[model samples]
Structures are given as structure tokens and as C-alpha cells.
Target: GPQIHRRTLLLTAYSGPVFFHILFYYCQAFIYGTTFQHTASQILAFTLITLHFAKRIFETIFVHVFYRLTVSFYSLYLYLFHYWLLSGVFMAYYIYYPGTCSSSISLLSSALETEETSLYFLSAVWIFAELSNFETHLILANLRIRYPRPIPKGYGFDLVSCPNYFFELLAWTVITLITRSLASLLFLIAAGLHMWRKAARKHEMYKKEFGSQYPKYRKVLIPYV
Candidate 1:
């Protein structure tokens, strides 16, 4: 099968989702004017989904270095839909649900009791996990520049083959918790499974490439694996 550079595929893939999310979120105005109001959770999902892809696009351009060079472009369809179209469609479904479009119908209300507190807590966790993921990417990007210098293990580089994947999954889980949306949960599961496989392969590659130099106890996106 034909392949494309990782950077190009990543940019194309993530960019698709960002566009879809924006379109779906603002469709009320575009398609029906300001006549419709979205629930607070819908708006929050829109923001976080946008922010998540924006971060990935930024990392693809500036933070990640391509060791593998290319991957199948078929992955572009899977990833593009995975990020943008899937989220947008799910979001559109919930946002456009009959008589449930008002802020009063907040999806966060699903959390019971501590809705506001829980939303805030999960949001804080999302921010932390996303930043942690970005930090790990920075470490990987610096690995070549830092050369003979010991790589930083403070971010759990020694505990997992891909702390970035763990953090990425954590961020998705936060969104799922905050929205309590089946849609977001579905996306999380898809992403988790995909990253889990990729992480395992990367872990194996690291072992074969660096052997004794790679951290001995490091696992693949999990501890005690």
C-alpha cells in the first residue's frame, strides 16, 4: 500500500476533525441562525475537542520527530473521522436532540450531586493530562538534541514506553466524564484501543533498537504490564 509522511498525514487527519467540530458547533447559526441554543455540555465538548486537535496539530508540526517516516494513508481516513467527523456527528446528534438544546438541559447534570464541582475537577484533570502529554512529547523531541545526556524520566518515561499515550487516554477519559456522553466514550474507546496497539509496537521497537539502553522496567502504556 502507498504511504505518506507522518507529519502530512497527522496534519491532514487532525485538521479534518477541527473543521468538522467547528462546523457542527456553529451550524445552528449557519443553518438556522441564532434560533437554537446548545446545552452547556455541548459547548464545552466543542471547546475541548477543538483544543485537543489544536494541540495535536501543534505537536505534529513542532514537537514530534518522525522516526518511522511514513504510515499508510488509509490511516488518514480512520484518524480524520476518528477525530473530527465522529465527534461532530455525535455532537450534532445530542445537540439537535428534540427539546434538549437549552443550557437548562446540561449534560453535566448526569454527574448527580456535585455537577459543577465534578465538571471543574475533570476539566482540571484534562488540562493536567494534556500538558503532561505535551511535556512527554517535548522530551522525545529533545532526545536527539540532548544525545549523551540522560533523558528526563521525571514525567514517567521510565514507567511507560509512551507516557504520552497514557496522558492522551487520560485526557479523553476526562472529556467522557465531563460530558457523560456515550459519543465521547465511544471515541475514547476507539482511541484507547488504537493507541494501545501502537504503544505495544513502539515498546517492542524500542527494545530491539536500544536493547540494554532502553529502560528495563518500562511497560507499554501501562504499569506492571
Candidate 2:
């Protein structure tokens, strides 16, 4: 397929959204003409997104290597919609909603504190998965350097063809649970579907490229599904 420059497309996609989130988050008063206090949960949402996308920007420039194969304009649209548009909702609607939706789970009610506990647990999981994803990318980068092609081996690789996708989904799942936003759910669905297709495609590629040496039992994106 005809494609754009990988680094240029990725930098634009990731950096644009990160800039939007930071601007909307801090400049709430200037944009909306009024300012409201940010709940703990809202802060967490903003922080996690910033960290996640910043990591992506860094990975795009330094970590991931792109060669002949490249993506279409669809990726540009998908990144903008997922990271920019839906994340705009996180800034404009979800965070500054001035309701329970924007408020911290711990402050909602007696049982809500337990929700915050789960939020903490989820955050931990997200961090772990993010690190693991980075590690996988490093592995791939190294492989493409000296080897014919990349073959993921460690972490969640033995189980899923794309553990990075699984980890990405898991991190987003945590974000959705923490923010409890419908827009976030929509983002999750959109990104998850795209990743599912990509995972299946890559799985087939590995099978054809590596033959029976590639793990036949390895699933696409998830273990059971």
C-alpha cells in the first residue's frame, strides 16, 4: 500500500494529541472561560495519558525502526480520532464535567473507596504492561538490526502473537475503568478492533515467514480469544 513517512506520521499523530491534552488540561479556564478543581481521578487520567503518549513519541523517534513496509493514511486518521478526538473528550467532557463522573472514586461513597483501590491496582498493571511493551519493542528493534526479521520471544510473546497489543489494550482498559468515561470506552473499542486485525495479520505473516517453527498455538491478541 502507498504510505506516508513513518516517523513524520507518528510524530504528528502522537505529539499533536499530547499537546492537546496538556493544553486543555492546564488551560481549562482560558478555553472554557471558567475553571474547576480537578479531582484525583481526573488528574490520574491526564497523567496516565501524558505518560503513555509521551512514551510513544519517544519510541517513535528512538525505539521503533521503520523500513520498506509502511502504513496508510488510515493510521493518521485513526491516531487523530483515537488519541486526538476521543482524548479531546477526556479533556473537554470527562475531566471537567463538574459531576461525579469527573470526581474521584474514593470520594463518591463508602463503597467508592474500594473502586479507588481497584484504580490503584489497575494503574500498577498499566505500568507493568507499558514497561513490558517497551521491552518487546526493544527486542524487535534489535532483531531487525542484525536478523532477517523480528521474532518476539519473551514476556507475553509465548502466549500471544502481539503481547504489545494486549498490553496496550490492558493499559487502556485500566484508563477506562479509572475515568469511567463512555468516550474512553469508544476509544478502547476502536483501538482494540484495529489491533485485533493487525495482530491476526502479523500472526499469519510470522507463520508464513517462519513456517512450522512459529508457534501454531499462539493466538492473535488475546490468550483465550
Model number with the top TM-score? 2
Clashes of 2: 0
Clashing pairs in 1: 17-84
Q: Write the per-residue lDDT of candidate 1 for residues 41-152, one digit (tens) a residue.
A: 5567677878998999999998888768999878877776776566556654554443342333245455544556656667788899999999998988888567564534
- Which stretches of model 2 miss by more than 4 angstroms? 1-3, 69-75, 89-92, 100-116
Summed over model 1, clashes come to 1
Supply the TM-score for candidate 2.
0.87
Give TM per candidate. Answer: 0.82, 0.87
User: Which segments of model 1 are wrong by more than 4 Å?
Assistant: 29-34, 95-113, 145-152
Residue-level lDDT of model 2, residues 49-168, one tens digit each, is 889999999999899977654678677887777667776645445555555355445543345356567667767988997998898788778877776775678788889999889988
